[model samples]
Target: MSKSITLDQPDQRNLLDRMAQGTIGKPVNRLEGPDKVSGVATYAAEFSAPGAANGVLVTSTISKGEVALIDEASVMGMPGVLAVISDQRMIARPAQGGAGEAPVQQVKQIDYWGQPVAVVVAETFEQARDAAKRLKITYNADDMSDVVLNPEDADSWEEGPGTETVEQGALPQAMSEAAYSVDATYTTEGHNSAPMEPHAALAEWDGTKLTVHASLQMLNYNIDELADSMGLDAENVHLLSPYVGGGFGSKLGISPDVAAASVAAMQLGRPVRVVLSRQQVFQSVIRRTETTQRVRLAADADGRLQGFGHEAKVTNLPEEEFAEPVTQASAFLYPGQDRVLKVEMGRIHRMTAGSVRAPGEAVGMQALEAAMDELAEESGIGPVELRLRNIPERHPSDDVPYSSRRLAECLKAGAEAFGWDDKDRKPAQRREGEWWIGTGMATAARIHNLSKAEASVTLMEDGTAVVATDMTDIGTGTYTILGQIAGEMLGLEPSDVLVRLGDSDLARGPGSGGSWGAASSGSAVQIACEAIREELCDMLGCEDEDLTLKDGFAIHNNKRQSLPELLNGRSIEKLGKLKPGETEDDFAQASYGAFFTEVAVNAYTGETRIRRMSGAFGIGRVLNEKTAKSQCMGGMVWCIGSALMEDMMFDHRDGHLANCDLAEYHVPVNRDVPHLDVIMVEERDPAASPLQAKGVGELGICGGAGAICNAIYNACGVRLRSFPMTPDKLIDHLPEI
Candidate 1:
């Protein structure tokens, strides 16, 4: 019988805590850490096969046009060049994670810049690159390709995914009646995710069967999409992705390299490999869209918000139908009845905009919290106090009670830890040795999304356990946590639980995106382990409470039974899946937190440095102390980058990026980061899952950038409406100290 669980009510014991194995919540080092550091782990491009061909993808030079001419004869005869394929089958658009509409595969015309135009295959990677450069290609450029977003283009704008009136309750009237209000507009520059691993795919075909080793997050979803892209049955495709360097959100779907390599291998009847250069990864991969937001807040004398309006404009390709869901957290982040939330998507030819990191709230909150700081100033109220006053008793928009919310607690705890009262209230008040010191804080909230996931656990004759799932560990410490879950359930150490992941043959997981990977997949693992425990209980003729499982032994009435003996000449395996329950629809479920940051600004140079950072996050349960802390710290560092460093620059003339490589597109290095402290606030939300756990991965990013941005303002008394408050922009705005 198949086992299943829908998290409706809270599990009384939550298995992990009740088991008390001293392993589930402990600080466990990654099981694969040694392999990763020692170079034994094989990534997608590292996999090798005999007689394999290397394929180089050729991207388009023009922003938008048709392939007017391309010389196949120019490169087909080159030494070691096997084939120069310009087939449309090699050109499929990227998938937008989950089960989004598959992109059009065969397009003779280009809609955006840097679209994959063709590919060249050769015996060696060097030969393929050499031949790809030799091919002569030209485009019949079109004039309509020049599309740019304008604030005045309101006449052409359409309502986003949700209607404007869905949550806007007499917002205009409330704004007019309020005693105090702050209305401001903020714009943010666009950026893209740069994982340590550039996308790569290795494909091998035997007869009609195909196997692809690719860097991917969702295995089953990718298998279906890859099979569809190749026009083959899903049964004929196998995707193997065991370890990934990092995904952020880039590897959540089918990348261009996967399709090109698969097509080349199928055609050549041998293994073919495709690896993207850093430039190609930046030019073709999805990006966090730039946004312009007009946030208006109206509050009473007591600093209680009366009205809220958040209208944002974001962009994507003219044909692609995905835009940044910029107002995702605005509907419920604070308490206000007369609320208005909207998103306007502009159809532009800039790099196709899609999910990068915390898609909606990362940029959205940067704009919202800045306005909040402005509101606090306008109302003559403290910043943290104003946020506290606006905390909602119920859902601000839907009128639903929260499943579990601790924003106020998080703020208070973080403030206490960060010395909110100790910091001087006056902006630019304290300066020493040409440095202006200041502190800032912001509220953090992110929607807790859950997807269906399945896993299988097998008990071996040697008393060891094995957990199998198709989830990829994108440096998020998934392998360690999965073992922790099984070990907690089976009464064994995490090391004794051999966890196999990133293979399509294993049970399908939700595939690690949207911060739902751990909660959803862990729930499935819990259900499978519970099912086996129940079977063992029945075989022992004892009730669940009557049995005790510990250290590879099951004891009832103090009579011990070896776990391997229970497996006794039988294939003891249980398959399980977890589904969304009634609580999701009944409540507004979200992870909540607060960020406090201290910064030192150069009095003369307008340069800013983050001095110290601290955050308190309420993500329900901390699965692993070390990994959870790492996730928060990584996100906080991302905040440092988003606030002052990272920006994706494009040529306004051609719509192509000028600084497409990492050498120019700056990310935060070790020197750019400072001291970071993370506090995981304890929460046990039955509504989250059987584990009573929510994700801590993206929570820090929701308002993390805003905290640092607000700090820069406090330090130099400059309210930057635009993002990446780079020193050049600050020099002109800074006060004459």
Candidate 2:
């Protein structure tokens, strides 16, 4: 028996026609916009249920030491306090071991400042907080520890899964052999996501079942980790994150806040909410790891690349394991003869660092792209021309043909739009008072990633369609995009489609990460909608070639029937799953962009201000122009912050982060940004997927910092290698030019 084949569009109509007639490219407002803007949208911290209590965590003051004692009697006696749980009692049944080589248990000796030592539950948030602060604890400090930030200290650490070790003095040897080379070291400070809503969770125990409302990027993974931590069956635990304000990358996994909240709820036999204070938010949740990058580029006199190498060392917590930030973009950016990229991890006694925004590429580009700009200078070529000369038509690492590449077009368009050809090239030549004006450009790229996702679409008798997937919005406008996909595929208006996401009970989705939210989830929705259309065609006894779906009606042989009439009071349902195919091995899929920046630097005070910025992207088949543009603009702003102000300062005296608050660790505000423009080149690649769409979230940010840093160098003859490129760093060495 051959399987029944279904095809609803055998007549062959242009896909763009169908998309234009539906909601695919329309600028539809977010479905949850009102709820979010009006302050009614519930975050993890705002979740509440009956019999709910409050919880607070106490962190260790010492960076490295063993806890000698924890006297919690005073804290437990406080008013409204329910219980105080210490690490000693919780260690009776340890959590399951990890999947890889890293240890699964919590650190016995405090390896970093702000490590959680105990948690307190009370009837009120104020009580829990007050009690937590009053508890006394002592630590046996160790003086043998030393902070690890210099590359020289990396020798003490061994090579791990995601890190590479390089021998001393080997970098200079590689740089001297090439006809053209740029040897430079760049440093970036640690920065936190600082989401408007801090990490919070509300956990409840109903008999043997556990339910948690937490803010996380991956719902299924959160459930699995939560179950494992509590030693409960996976089915017995449920996780939900309906909405999130913003999660650049901090909320990728289960944080300490979720585990502490669940443990308190289970012990108290009542619902509990744990909301970390702003101060605690900095120390408790994950932050971006600090990095020192040394990049060398070896190119021929004509600027044709010969060899390229990047060596980076990142600070990691002694207790926590993390991947290095360099070598992320080295795998596939440019064509070269010999490319050697190494990433080394140096353990530092600080808060555990994790992903923030684009993670590796965010920092990697700051070094690699800047080196490209320097190489352009040495070769006496324009930055855009230099990039064009080195453009890789295919992946250099794996030797696979690109599914689609338009980076050259992006560079040309962006340069033309930003007036790069007419800008001043020499430092101090176009000075206005104390400011010197200059322009710079860089290129960006990100892999088009897709994962296995399942979605369900139900057609109701009222001609409405409901789509459900476990994907999360995370303030990236996922709901609107998913709705657009479903509406386009099912031939319905945007208003006629409903979207439900961020619940483990729904059909599993790819979850939001690696810029794959829109492409993967939208593809899933498309598959489910196609299944529903096929089912309707079968029930109407119509041949697939003679059918057309428009305005909630199916047309066959010049006869039109409303979806309601075809349903006959029966609802049609379909399930769609996206599975990996041979295309993964056959082709390399990536999204590319070109970033351009114009900056004006003060010659006297060394203060640099971004005058104007623009970016052009070749992200295959933009689903929504407005949202895509917004994503690009947001990334540019983030890169500006990284270049001028964002940095996390560590107190080398105690291995504690000194600038733990936003006031001390600055990000870009409206006053810091200037006029910006974003252009998206619309192209389609059939090999990417049925939708021929790629991820755009991270591409906008990939090379942003590098462009700004290069512009600063152009405006002033002085070369500032360290990030946050502050005025103090450049003031002492201001050039006379």
Candidate 3:
């Protein structure tokens, strides 16, 4: 049987709490951990097929132009070389995450410096790489002077084509009349997803059918993308992505490697494999848009906000619809009657800009919270107290009630836990030897989102259960959480629930993007288990609410029976579906949190070291504590990198990415990171999901960088309006000891 529900209204049943088997939110270890550690799991590039050849992509050397000639004869006679492919169906760029179709597929025209133009195939990986590098290619290059690399250059921008603007009142008037005000501009550099695994794919074509094992985040959408790119019907495609090393957001859609491998395999009548080099991954994959934001805040003497304004300029390729939504959370994050929020996208000849980790608020909140700190100083109030005074009761612009909120609780609890009172809050007032020590804090928020999802749950007569879906784990514990949800509802241990995932033949699931996979997919599993429970009730001749199930046994009105006895010789399988409805837009839904950090800055040199950090989050209900904490900790690590180290260096002269590998592009190492603490403030939000849970993967980084930035200011009395507060940007501005 199939069960379906569209969340038109809030579901207040809280059925998981009433379940007799207690495993939903338990801190159980990952079910796939042993396989992953033992090398028993297969990743995309690890799959083997008979007579498979290796393929390497050749990228354009010019920033802008069209391929004029490809001298295939130059590499045809090379040792171990098989063939060179320059097909018209080759994708120009990677599809944006969640984009249902492939990106424009005219590879002859190069839009960026490192756009892939051809693929070289050979019997071995080394021969393929060598032949690809030696494959002579010529381009009809555009004038270098015509390329627009700087997003803030007003003369070059194709302005406001995809701009988003919101206004409820006259922000200028309120700003002019306010007792205290702040207006500042902040700039952030582009960022990459930088997942541990580079993009890879193995494709095989058997006459009419095409099968691909690829590193992808959203298979339900990726199948359509791959099929559309190949000009084939969707039914002719099969995809398997059972294990993903990591995506962050880079693998959300089909990339060049997948397209190239598929084309190669179909042309040669054999299987082909393609794995992107690290530098290729950096230069060709999607990047987070660089932003230039102007934030304006108006407030009373008591630190109450009266007006708020956030205007930002972000960049993307010309004609591309995906623009970084830099002002996403500013509309309702704080209380202000007069508000203006705008995002103006500039068309540039850089790499395609799309979601990284937390697309909108990752960089947006860094500037917003810094401006809020300035507002606190201007209003002569403490930072935490100022924030407490400005929590909006409803959406400031939409006037919609919040489905659930814990911003206040998070701030209060985090402050208490981090010892907010036992600090010298004045800038440059505390010093130890040659280092200045200080503490700071900021609020975190990310918009809640949901998507259509479906999963199947089967209760076997052998007293075990199975859950199947197309959702990819991406190292986020999807395998464990789904197993836990099924085990809780069906009166079985998590160990006894077999979770099969990452195959397109299974029930389609909402893929892991925007942090909605667990809730959306888990809700489907929950609904399927609910259907099984109703069947068990029929067998016991009792109502669902009156039955108690635990330890593989069902009890109804004091009558207990083992599940194997109840099922006899048959197994029950049910498919459940979840779709978003009116409730998605009827209320303002978002995950809320707070971050606190302490830092030490060298008085002589501009070096800064984090001393300690803590974050408290309310993501509705946590499905698993261990995984949730790990995600938060990982996001906090991103916070450290974004605030001080990570930057994608793009040369404006030719739109070339200067730092195209991890060696030059820095991330926090173990030595750079300090001891960390995470607090999960659990709540029940019926409107969020059937599990009463919201997404938490991206929330930990929403405004976390601002806390580190603010702490730097408190330590050294230097305030930087740029991302990556490198020592050079701070040393000259530091106070004289």
Candidate 4:
């Protein structure tokens, strides 16, 4: 049997709180941790097929043009060379889909520098690599003359479709009359998702069906994308990603590896395997769009904001519809009646621009919070105090009450825990040896979202339970959380509940993007467990309110009965489905937090080093204390990288990515990070979901980099508007010791 619930109204039952197993929010170890550490888990490429041939993709070297010809005969005679597939279906940019459908087939028209044009298959990996490099390709280059390689070219911009300009009141008048104001422009470079697992796929075709094992996220949507790209029915495509190393939004859609492998398998009538090199992953995957933002804020003498504006410019490929949403949290983060927000997109010859990590707020809030720091300085108020005063009671643009907001609490808690001093306002006054020390703070916010999901829970006759869903873990602890939810509801130890995930044939979940996996999919499991509880009540001939299940036994009227005896050799299975409705939009819902950091700036070298960091978050409910804290810690690490080292460099003339591998690109390593403190201020919002939990995966990175940037300015009195805060940009502007 199946049970469905649409979240149109607040669910006040709070059933997890009443469960007697007492394992819902505890720090349970990951169910699959041993498997992962012991090398027993098999990732996508590890799966073996009977007669698999290796394939290597051939990428374009030009920015934009049509493929004139691919000399297939050039590579066919090579040793062990089997086939060369150049089908148009193998090159669709999977992340640039329109609405709910697959993106248009790219055909032979090259859109970017590293776009995949064809694949070379052979008997072995070395043969395929040799053949792909030697295969000759030609292009007309007619479109290259008009290609726009720079996003800053003013004439190449267009109003992005589906992006809107928000206006509430007269912003110009309010800005001019305010007692204090700030207007500044900031820039951020592009970034890669850089998941641990490079995209890899193995495909087998049986003349009537295709089975592929690929590294991916969101199998529900990926199934449709792969099926559409291969011109096959969705039912005929069996995609399995049972063990994914990591996604980080890089594997959210079907990449060239999956497409090329599927296409090659069908054409050759044999199994095929495709694996992308690390350089290929960096150059071909979707990147986070670089941003240029102009933020204006008007505040009274007391630092109460009266006007706010954030105008941003982002870039994408000509046919790509996804422009990084740079102002997602700006409209409601502060109380400003006279507000305006706009996003302009420029066409450029680059990799497809799409979501990376937190997308909008990860880079957006870095600029927004830095501008707020400027406002605090101009008004002679503390940065924390200024932000505390501008906390809006209602959403500024939507005029709706908040479901649950704890931004103020996070600010206060973080300040107290970090030992922030509002009285020490002067810069360059505190010095330790050759370093100047200072502290800074910034607010964090990520919009709450819910998606439709389905999961199944089955109670067996052996006094155990099983939870099955297509949701992927992606190193975020999905396997443990789902097990906890089922165990909490069924009165069993978390270890006793078996959790099977990352298979397409199971009940489809909402997948792991947008930080909604735990809450959305966990809700379905909770609902299914609730149905099993009702069945037990019926079997025992007792009312629902009188039953208390605990320790693998049922308790009613001060009597206990073993579950095996009550089951009587019968198993119960139930499917639970969740659908979002009016409640999704009825209230302004977001997870709130505050980040604080301390840093030391070297006077001579103009280098910044983090000393300490702390963050306090209010993400509706905490499913696992250990995982939640780990997520916050991970976000803070990303913050350190974004503020100091991470930057994607591109060649100007040809639009090729300059840093095509980790050796050239930079990320925060162990030496760059400091001790991090994470605090979870757990709360519940009935309006958010049936489980009363919100997304926490991306919350840690949203606006966190601002804290590090502001600390740099306070430490050396240098306010640089550019991102990464490279030493070259700071060396010339450093104050004399």
Candidate 5:
């Protein structure tokens, strides 16, 4: 039997106020609805005009080794073939104080599988693709190329933040004194974004200026990188990515497709369009690094953590680098006496891996949350209770007070909603014919990171407002949310507010990543609206404090003046930006969630299926409930994929990705997911930003996989350490009846 207790009364008035103040808590429709649904939204590959030249990218056959020869004559002689460009002469070394600063400009060494060997440009895409196949290239084989780091080889690799040459040999010493320790090694296979539309770019050069329609996350970053690669002035490059199918961090930088298209256009004196093939997409674009994490956790007798250590090694390009930072969130997520978070790197003959969704915490939470579940079981306490008991009121990293922390509230609410109190903690106690029933819980936390963003709001004579920013939507509802904010501030309906984004020429806002787009961009739009309101009051010569703007009309002395009449044919434009304030330094702001799952496991086969899953999110404020809920649901679906089927297999013997296509690498389909119950705990945190909203994008996926894993353990009396808790692994560990 279970008891339900409702501690806090639902405040409908407050909820309505939140919705009325802005679209901060409402479920407004997406602003780009018509564009997306009506097939009017132009993706990179669909922007081709007639007579545009085409370029085909050639990928390296071998994982490693230098290109021995490039015979381009046959490719050049092919019909409609314009030219063949390789690393031989056209690609120059980066110049000093030029655009290609950083690793983007660094060199011609073939460090990983799928590296670009050459590019074939022609009058038609078919001709270019055929020409690419005719190119002759040989490699000087190196046995050291296929080398992968193992536990025994861990010591041989250098330690640093993805750089070579640093003080090594720290893991052994740290693992020694860990009181309650679990020295478990976990591996996550490589995965690519595999967006529906492959990476494509259409570049046209009008002598001095170059314009590129690209598939990129950061338009400005792409513009700068392209300018540097082409040795042109940064001002000469104009990049646009109005719509992106999906990025998942793969589109963070300008990939070879963009660079190849630009170079081909420059050479042929005609516009060039380059679209990478599915196979080339697999090899050339960046993917999530295959990481192996060795984690050592030490906690006191009271289950209070004392020491935490994590070391991760990733397969990355010889020159391209990254630190998995798997131990980053561990420093502050829990209350600990001593914490050491060190990141190390290993060079492998693989594609360069970059940020994917939540870079550090996403993977870190997988190991950390699972370890927390294990520790809770070892302590003879429920997972939810253990987390509640160990909750920290402040951030451990800097001992700063939290502006708002509703994690405990979220846990309590989630437990009540999930019927946690009635759950059978004993493994294999409840059985339903061929299946065993079990329940599990896990918690997630994410820091709120908002950047300086600027937006221009123009109040037109037609009683409408247009908000323009360089922010990319990325399927996260930036377009809708920004329009909602502008609509509220300008006292107009959502339809009356037009939102323009994803062009470098617009008011520059932070590119949508790190879950900062909504908070940062919304705040910028708010500031701009405030400026416009102030300007309207100044023009009316009325006391700014005494005037109230509503329903597209300004009221002064019981007289209503329409915004269009007030503007008097001249558009009212105001630009505003939001910078980090002292509150950011004084207070730690983070979003928290409690994920609960109930699953059924087959007694004999150990097959597991999730019955129901619920997430109680305590993000500061819910901006557009429909979109936020969708984001959470999407993440949950992603978690379902990660928990059961997602993995990129590599042929360890040859250093090639075995499962490179969708047919081999699996994600969760509609059949895998059930209805996900999401509850948003609305709490306002002034520390996060003026919007009082935190990121909910990655938090939903953080601990969801672990929760499912824990549930499976309770159902079948099996403790599986590795991921994708497949049926075979579970059956092997199942106890005899």
Candidate 6:
């Protein structure tokens, strides 16, 4: 008597609003908060494996060419060096954004600098580190490598394979005849995600079956990837992440350390533990690609767009099939019939290039929105007014209508909250002592995605519900929000519902990236709860529509029945599966927001400090208020880092990362971040999901940096095109003022 609803079309039911339990949108604290704060939560390498040995990885010093020799005998006779493992079986780790599968290489070659070449295992970590330094590795270096570390040296370029060009209504005529236009190039340096926890792994081999604990984001994908890297079948390998401090996409795929640890464990007939040093984490992980974008905008006297052009140049390794999608939103960000766009991916060997945080739009919008600010100045229009004027009614490249868009609403609401109309319009107008004060704003947009997820919910005999899924929390409150969803649908409180996450043995989920984890996993929970409700309705002799579940009791026709009593001293288990439906094709969906920042700049020194920041976000129906705000605040912190001082510095001659540790590479500290506020708007997007919820995890970072970049111009009247508007970049330009 169970029921299921396929969300293949728009849904206006708003079922959660009618639920008797009111926990879905409440500001519930994270269910795992105590465990995390008390340090009882276990992460990778924390588990004490059986007879686990310690391994220290050795990385290559050369950029390219074969390993000329390895003096293995130099370290084997050392105090406790059990094994020095380097073979074709331990292949190059599969990078997430590169080819999904890594094939075994015949030659022991170094693809880039800092690549893992070998691993030394010993009884203790001290012996491993001490003996690893004793071994010597020689390489036949390729000094004539085509490794372009600097963008300026990349002279000749080719068009991106997937670039789209639009030529409608004569672009040359549109630009020539427009009343206002802006054409400029912007460059952004490469950066790292730098999550709190570094990559680590613990592996144990019971005969042929290998069990591993790694700090990875997606476990479902990792099981097969780790097996492939070790030349084992997926059935023989099992990985458990259970709890991840944070990944930010660095731990998406199986890194080399995971492979080396498994190899050492399999050869030595014992478990092996590998924990990356902070410097090694920076040297090995995938980083955000450096980008240079040229934007040309044509607008009428009223500030409405007439033409749009964006050409972006990004860099990646030759073997990688990925590049920074810098112009992702330009096709629909504005409606312009006359347009032209180009994208190029420079082949280079730097730190591995891939997704970090928001990936594409985080750096893309930094250039696009700043160009819009310049366009506004050229047109003598307010920054907010200019964005409101160019709000697209439909996808410009394609003729698709938006499923739901709230960009205009976000801009207006943010303006009202920040007192946009009453602010001084002149740059450096308001000065307090030696500091100049100014404010700026930018519109936020990110393409919302929907992925498939399967979850199982079991209603226990004691009137409790348990949800099982493989989604990792990644410090985003997945435990609390999933519990809330199940609690609202079933007749239970948030505390009464139990949630088990981060196990590959559980039902599959989207696994917490691209901001789609909550929607994908939550939809499965919703459907499973519905099935349970249907079974209960059949037992109560009433229609599911007429049933009301509240506080472990079912009410229909003014009659109440205890859930446990109706269960007949047994538990009922229900499984839910969610797949892509026709609803995604029916409408265009994206999360929209506006970010505003106030800054104070020292006139004498070229230093800038953010005074405060506020954001107005319209990301469908919010699951939990507290968690959503926390995500926004974190995004803004990354914004501050990007605008002030965050970059992966590289040596021009050798292509080696210069500052590979966090001590030299600065992120935001307590004093660096200031007061921040957020306003969450529930738009109730019927086309997004059955739960009517969209993603807000990465949207806040997409446009957060643009506001700070614009604020620098307002305070100092200097527009530094290059990223990380550092004091050196500003001081020279500020001498005229």
What is candidate 6's TM-score against the reference?
0.96
State the displacement of the C-alpha of residue 393, model 5, in Å, after optimal TM-score superposition: 2.5
Please give, for residues 1-737, the per-residue lDDT of candidate 5 as tens digits: 11111112211232213323354568998888788999999998889765799998887776656777778876777799988877432232223432121233222456566678678888888988888988887787567534542223433455545332212234345346544556677666666677777888998988999888888777646666677778898789888888987777777777788878888788777889989877667766766766677666666666666556566666455555455556656656776545555566666666666777677777667767777777777666678877887777777657888778888999999899988863337787788888888888888777778777788898898789899987887888888888888887777878888899899888778787778788788878877877777787788888656676667888888889988788788888888777766676777767888889999988788778889999999888787899998988888887777777777676655556677777877887777888899999988876676677788887787778888888887887787767777788888777676
Between prediction 1 and prediction 4, the one with superior lDDT is 4
lDDT of 3 at 574: 96
Better of 2 and 6 by lDDT: 6
Model 1 alpha-carbon miss at residue 316, Å = 0.6
Considering only N, C-alpha and C atoms within 3 Å, which residue pairs clash in candidate 3? none
- lDDT by residue for model 6 (349-449), tens: 66667778887789888888889888888888989888888988888877788888888888888888877752345676767887878788888888888
lDDT value, candidate 3, whole model: 0.89
Error of 1 at 52 (Å): 0.9
Query: Largest lDDT belongs to which candidate?
Result: 3
For model 2, the superposed segments whose C-alpha errors exceed 4 Å read 1-20, 87-108, 144-155, 163-177, 319-321, 422-424, 543-545
Model 3, TM vs. native: 0.98
Measured by C-alpha RMSD in angstroms, how accurate is candidate 6?
2.2
Candidate 5, residue 731: how far the Cα is off, in Å: 2.4
The 10-residue segment of model 3 with minimum total lDDT is 92-101
Which regions in candidate 6 have their CA more than 4 angstroms from the true location? 1-7, 92-107, 145-147, 155-169, 422-424, 735-737
Stretches off by above 4 angstroms in model 1 are 10-13, 93-106, 144-155, 162-167, 422-424, 569-571
Per-model TM-score, in order, reads: 0.97, 0.93, 0.98, 0.98, 0.91, 0.96
Over 4 Å off, model 4 = 93-105
Off by over 4 Å in 3: 92-102, 154-163, 422-424
Going through the candidates in the order shown, the clash numbers are 0, 0, 0, 0, 0, 0
Model 2, residue pairs in steric clash = none
